[model samples]
Target: MAVEIDTSAFTEEAYELLSELEDSLLELEERPTDIELISRVFRAMHTIKGSGAMFGFDEVAKFTHEVETVFDMARSGTLPVTKALIDLTLAARDQIRSILDASRGGPPADQDNANRIISGLRALAPQKGGAAATETKAAAAPKADAEGPHVYRVRFEPKPEIFSSGTNPLLLLNELRDMGQCRVVAITNTLPSLEELDPERCYTHWEIFLTTTQGENAIRDVFIFVEDDCTLNVRLLTREEEQEDAEPKKLGEILLERGDINEEALGKALTPLGDRLVNAGVVSADKVRAALTEQRVVQEQKQQQTKAAEVDAVVRVPSTKLDKLVNLVGELVTVQARLNQISGRLNNQHLQLVAEEIERLTGELRDNTMSIRMLAIGSTFNKFKRLVRDLSTELGKQMELTTAGADTELDKTVIDQLNDPLVHIIRNSIDHGIEKPEVRKAIGKPLVGQIHLSAVHSGTSVLIQVKDDGKGLDAQLLRRKAVEKGLLSPDAVLTDQEAFMLIFGAGFSTAEKITNVSGRGVGMDVVRKSIESLRGTIDVQSELGKGTTITLKLPLTLAIIEGLLVGVNHDYFVLPLAAVEECVELSPKDIANSHGRRIVNVRGEIVPFIRIRERFAMDGERPIIEQIVIANVDGRRVGFGVDTVVGQHQTVIKNLGGSFQYSDEFSGATILGDGTVALLLDLARMVRYVEMQETKETGGA
Candidate 1:
C-alpha cells in the first residue's frame, strides 16, 4: 500500500519529539547514568528517525540516525554518559532544532558543524566491535529472515510536493533496508509521459517488503507519517508462505480467517477499538478523550500524548473580561451603598431587612472576585536565586538567599509591577550591600554573605523587605554625595533617615567603584518611582557595618481600599485604615499646650502631628474638640487632626489622573454613597513629609 506523506506534519512531529528528547537530556544532567533517562532519549530519537523517513524528512532521518547510534553505544554500556558527552549532545539538540526550523526556507545545514557534532558523538561509540564484523552484519542482516520472521509490505506515495520538501525517497528505502530483510520497488505507473511531466511534482511511489522479528506494529510505524495521506496494509507472512508464493494476509483477511472476529463486527469495532484500548490502558485516557473530542484529528496524531502537547499551550484572553466583571461588581457595591443609605434614612423594617441581605451577598461577591486575581509573590521572588547565584559566582563571593513568607499573597497586578523594583533591590544588595569575603573576614564577619527576601501582611498592606548581613550603607558618605551632587546644601544638618533617603535620589549612587552590576546611579530612584506608582511607599534602614534593609509597603489590591473617612473643614478625606492605629478626641487643654507646633503627647511618647485642614489646604475654619487620627508610617507615629471621624468605609479607589499626579498627600479619589468624591490620603507619604518639616525646624533650633 502506498502512503502519501505530509511534509509539514512530519516536521512538526519531529520537532515535538526532539523537544521531548532535549528535556530528557536536561533531566539527565544531574544523574548521567540514569538508565531510564537514557532509554527515553533513545526512544525519542528513534521515533523521529522512523517517522521522518516515512514522511519524507530524509535529512532529519539521516541526521538523527548517527545521533541515535551514539546513544545506542551508551545504552549497551560500551560508553558512559560523560559530562562532555551531555554538553556535546545538548549542543547537538540545539542544532537539530535549528535544522528543523530552517527546513522551510533556510539554506542547507552547516555540514561541517553537523560532522563535527557527529564526530564527537562517534568518539563515544565502542571500538571493541571490529569494523569488518559490523559491516558484515549490516550487509547480511537484511537477507537473514526465515521461519516465523514477521514480514510487512508497505506502499507509500508521498504528496506531489515531496520532492521540493528536501526529501529523497531513496534515503527512506535505504533506511528500511538497513533495518532488516527488505526490498523496495518504486511504482511510477502514475507518472506522466515525458512530454507532459512536471519535474517539481512527485511522480513515484514505493512498495516495500520487510521481514523481521520486529512486530507488525513496528512495520506500520514506518508508515506512521504518511498513514493519513496514503493507503497502507501491513500483515504477517511466514517464510513457508513466502516460499510457497502466497500473498501476505491483509488485516481484515487475517481476522476473518483466524475466526478471532467476524467481518461485520470487526468493521464496527475497528472504529472504536482505539478508544476502548485507550480506556483499557493500552493508550492514554487523555488521548482517547482528545480523539473523541476532535473527530477531524488523525488517529496517528491522536495516539501521541495529549498532555505533552498541552504542557506548553497557553491562551491569551482579553483583560476586558476581568475589567467588565470588576465593573459589574463595583456597580453592585454602589447599589448596596445606596440601599444602606436608604435604610438609614428610613427605619422601615422591610427596607432595612432587604438592605442587610443585599449587603451580605454583595460583600461576598466582591471578595470572591478580588481573590481571583490574588497570587503568591513567591514565584516572582524565586527568579532571584539564579541572579544571586550567578552574581555571587562572578564576584567570588559566597552568598545564600533566604526567603520567608513565600505564601504571602497579593494582587496579581501589584506583583507584576513589583518584579523589576524587587530585582533592582536584590541586585543592589548582591553587588554593593554585600561585602566581599576578604573584607568581611577582616571585619570579623562570616565569609558568606546572607541576603534575605521576606514578605508579610501588615494590616491591609503587604510589606516586602530585602535585608542583607553585609556592609550597610554609609550615611556619612550618602550625605557627602548629596552635598556634592547639589541635592543638599553644603552645611545642611541631616538626621540618619534623611541621609539614607539620598540613595533614592537620581544619580546618587555611593559605590566607590563601578562594575557591570551596580553603581550606575539609577537603580534606587527607579525602585522608588515604581513603588510610588502603585500607591505604595518604600523605607530604607541600615546599620553601619552590619547590613541594610529596604522595605516596600503596598496595598493588598489596587481596586478597592478599606479607609477611615475623616471630616476636614466640612470636606471628607479618607485615610487608609491599615495605617490608622487609633483615634483620640483632642481636648482644649491639649490643643492649647501644643504651642502652634504639630506635636502631640500620646501616652509617654511624643508623636508628630499634622493638621488635616492645613495639609489639604481646606478653606473653612477649624472645629472645636478636634478628632485626631494616629497613623504609623515606617515605625513612627504621626497624628492627623480632623473635625470628626466618619467611621470606616470600603471605598472603591479611582485614579486621580495627571491633574493630581503630584499631590503626595492624596493617593487617589473615591466616590461616596451621596455622590461626593473624597480624596484618599496616602498616610505614609503625608507622615513622611510632616516628619521632614519637623526635622528641619528642630535642626534650626
Candidate 2:
C-alpha cells in the first residue's frame, strides 16, 4: 500500500513535469538558440528519469533516459536544437506519459508509435556506429570514468523535518554505494534523549568516504530531490593526498585540518589522541570518533567550493483536500449567518457584537479559501498553444495564438470547465475564421493570421475574449443561411447582433461543406451551453473582411458571491451585486404615468422593468411602492421590481437541481441569513427571454 502511494506521488510529479516540458519544448521551437530553455528541457527530463527509476518505473526510466541523453547532448553543445529534434522529443514525452498511465491500469502505450519516435530521434543524432543502442549501457558502466579512482568526502546533515517529506536517507546511501567503494559513518551527537525525542524526526548526520571513477556531480545527483532540505558538502581529494593512502593520519591532524579544534588544543592532546582529546574537552566526542574512523580508512578530501542550498518553499497537496476545505468553510459561513440572525432577533448588544465579529472573520476565511482555489489561467492557456500548432498544420494555414493577462486568476473549477469552451472557440476561429495564407496575403493582411486570447478582471467578474484577424463573420450570409435552414423567416428583418447570435442556435451552420475540424454545427452551441452553465454571458462582435471577437463575461467563482438580497411578496431573490447599478422607487403613479407599461423613468433615464411577482407567477397584493433594482444586463440598463430591498448578503450558492431545470430565468439558489432560500436571477437570459416575448407580441415591433 505504501509503495502504491509513493508511486502515485511520482506519477503526479511526472504529469506536472510533462506539462512543463511541453511548454518548454514549444517555447524552444521559437527560441532555438536559447540555452536556458534547453537546460530547462534537460532538467525536467532528468528528474523524471531519476524519480521514475526510484519508484520502480523501469520502463519510464529506460525510455526517459534515452530522451534525457539527447537533451544532455544539446546541453553540452554536441547536438543542435532543431525542429525535428523538438518534434521527436515531444512524441517521446507523450510516450513517457502513456507508460506512466499504463502502470496505473490505463490502456497500454502505442509501441509502434513509440518505436517510430525513437527511430526518428536516432536518425537526427550524430551517429557513431549506432551510439543510441549503447548509450543506456554506457550510462551504467564505469568505463567512462577511466581516470584514477578519485576520492570524495561528503557531509550530509538533514533537517529534522526531512523524514516527514518522504525521503529515505538509506536509499540515497545505497545509490552512492552502487557508484563506488564507499564507507558511511554516522554521527549521533545530535540525537536527543528519549524524553526529548520525537520519533518522526531525523537526528543523525553522516560523513562518507567514497572512491569512484564518477565525478562529484554524480554523487550530488543522488540527493537531488532533498538537496534543499539538507546541508550537503562534497569535495575531492588532492592528487598528492590520493598517493598518501598508505599512511594513516592522526586524529589531531584531521581535526586541525577541518578547523574543528585549534592547533594549540590539538598539540596539547597526548598519544591515544581521540580519547584523550574528548577527556580534555579539546573537541566533542563525536568529532574525535569521526576523525578516528577517517584514519581507519583513507581520509577523504580538502576544501572545495560548495553549492549554497536553497530552502524548499512549496508543499504538494491533493486537490481533493482543498475541495473538502472549501466545503467546510461554506458550512461555517452558513452557521455564521444563522448566528447573526439569532443575535438580531434576541436584541442583545453583546451577542450582536459577537455576531458581527464572527461575520467579519467568516468573510475573511471565505475569501482566503477561495483564493487557494484560484489558479492563474496561464496553465490552461499553454495547452492551447499545442492545440493551435497542431490544428494549423492540419488545416494548412499559417496562424499564431497570442495571449494576454494569462496571470489573471480564476476559480480552479471555473478554469477546468472553461477548457472545452475555449477549445471550441479556438477551433472555430482556426477552421472557419482564419483564411488561408494566400487568401490573407491577397487580402492585404499579413501572411500569418493572429488569434488573440485575453482575460481581465471586471468588478467581480472576469472577461475573457477570443479575437481573430481573418475574414470575419458575415451577418447577411448568416441570416440567409438561417432562413434557408428554417431557423429564421425569409421575410424577417434582423439586426446584425441577432444574426451573429444565430450561430449558437442548434443545427445552425454557415459552412460551405463539412470537414473534420468543424461544420457539424455543434461547436458554437456547445460553447453557449457551457458558458451559460457557469453563469457566464457571451457576446459576439465582428465586421466583414476584418475580424471577429467573442467576449465571455464570467463570475470569478461559482461557490460564493457578493449578492444583493431583495424580497418580492413572500419570496426572495439574489442579484449579483457586480451587475446591480442602483435602485429606484416605482410607485403606482409612476406605473400610471407609463400607461401600464413595465417601463419607468429613473432620473431622466428610461429603463424597462420586470415585475418579479408577476414573472414568478406569485399571486399576492402588490406593494404601493416597489423597489426597482436597476442592473446592467448585456450593456443595457434594466430593472427587476421587488417588494422591498433586503440589503447585501454573503451568499453561499447552492444549485436549484433538476426540478427547476426547465426554466432559464434563475441560475441558482443561496441560503439567506434568516434561513430563507433566495433564487439567483440569471439576468442576461431573463432579459433575452422577455425581449423575445415582447417582440412576438408586438409583431416584431
Candidate 2 minimal-lDDT segment of 10 residues: 302-311
Q: Per-prediction TM-score, please? A: 0.59, 0.75
Q: After best superposition, candidate 1 residue 688: deviation in angstroms? A: 2.8
RMSD of each: 17.3, 14.5
Q: Write the per-residue lDDT of candidate 2 for residues 1-701, one digit (tens) a residue.
A: 35434577899989999999999999999998776687679778888999988988888887887787777666545578998998899889889989988988999999898878877766666656444543643454323233435677788889999999999899999888866668888888778899999989999988887876567777888898999999998977434324333445666777887667998887788878778788888677877776766665554432211111112345777999998898889889989989988998999999999999998998899999999999999999999998998898899999999999999999999999999999999999998899999998887999999999999999889999999998999999998999899989888888999899998988888888999888889999999999999999999999889999999999999998889999987788999999999999988899999997899898898999998888778988999988999999989999999999989887888878899989898888987766778999999988888889888998873
- Candidates in order have lDDT scores of 0.73, 0.84
Tell me, by lDDT, which candidate is best.
Answer: 2
Candidate 1 residues 1-701, lDDT tens each? 98765577667667767666665775676588775677678777778888878877787788787777666656544568887777677667767777777878876677788888877766555453543333333333222232324545555668788666566667767756645556565656567899999988887766566655445655665556655555565545343333233333344444355343455654654445655443444333433332232232222122322444465474433456876787788778877888899898998999999999999999999999899778888777766765686688788888988899999999988998999999899988988888889999998999999999999998789999999998888888988888888888887888998798888899888777888888879998999989988988888899998999999998899887688988886578998888889998777788788887667788877777788888767798777688888998767788889999999998888779898868877878888888888898877778767767877878842
lDDT for residue 313 in candidate 1, whole number 0-100: 75
TM-score of 2: 0.75
